[model samples]
Target: MKLFNIVSKTTLTLSLILFSQNVSQTHVYAGVENASPPAVGKTAKDFSLSNLNGKQIKLSGELKKGPVVLLVLRGYPGYQCPLCTRQVGQFITSAAKLKSANATVVMVYPGTAKDLNTRASEFTRNIKLPANFQFLLDPDYIFTNAYGLRWDAKNETAYPSTFVIGTDGKVKFAKISKTHGNRSNVKEVLKALSSSS
Candidate 1:
């Protein structure tokens, strides 16, 4: 009876282990699928930005899966940008489509550090982000200037920009808009993402 009890216990343990392994393998994969955003065929410039939640995020770190869509958002330019709001919403709505392609989207919100978090928090309040999407704060225009998107005008911040980068850390496609509303549309970015990956 002791030996029989020992065999049953081992069998139960093995079954539990197998069940756990299956659960782990079938769980939904989350996080950035891994990528870059620079110029087509040019090596992307690496960058790190803090999210409104005070977490640091790196470009190369996100590109582990190959393609990433980068959006440069106008941060608190005297007020929240309506175009940015609309564009972000569109992206969020299309999150499932983007994720299926194994792509990650990174949005950069740039502004002076003063009251940046408060304003950024306000900006993010209404949006629900998916696992593959990250909204990063570019305090004091560090990333804006580095990427040459700083507008440097009164009540103006970074110029709106969109980029598609590949897993090899190369900019596959890049578009910079001089005017506030002259940004890339969702279709174009989606196309770039499919092609880049």
Candidate 2:
């Protein structure tokens, strides 16, 4: 009877351990379900991330100068994302329009820690960033997670997102794209920048 009681207790303990492990795995897998996309009229969350030059750029600091157009990019997912490249090029083409409307453009490239700096520098190289534009690196996706843009699992970096922040430090417009191809265009962002009151 004593031996049977000891075995039964050990089994119960093992079952509890297994149950805990399952719960933990489930929690990790259940990534952002009901999170609504960030919207206009909300205060855009401020972040300070390092640039390729290792300089810290703050979102709030940019907003102090004028409105800001923020773009989040996927970085180094075993290959450069062509869709991100195209969207970035479009923004570059519209630089004048964004600046004319008193807006600073910032592109964030997020990647894993191993190659974040190298990849971010490579991504921005030779691109003519206007005086009002900056490229930021979200190493290990700290800022991405803060903004709820982290694509949980499958080795994904982050979901593409754009925010138009007003000089008043509030988000004037926001577009969060779930997939690769459905990002906000430069024209639409320009319109929002121009129409911001």
Query: What's each prediction's TM-score?
Result: 0.79, 0.79
Q: State the C-alpha lDDT per candidate.
A: 0.85, 0.83
Q: For candidate 2, lDDT tens digit of each residue in 11-120?
A: 99999999999999678535535444457898876789988888999988998889989998888787888898899889888788787888898899998878988877
Q: Please state every model's RMSD to the true fold in angstroms.
A: 14.1, 6.9
Alpha-carbon lDDT of model 2: 0.83
Q: Across residues 107-187, which tens digit of lDDT does each residue of candidate 1 receive?
A: 999988988899999999989999999999888877787677778788899889998888888887889888988788778
Give the Cα error of residue 58 in candidate 2, in Å.
0.6
The number of clashing residue pairs in each candidate reads 9, 0
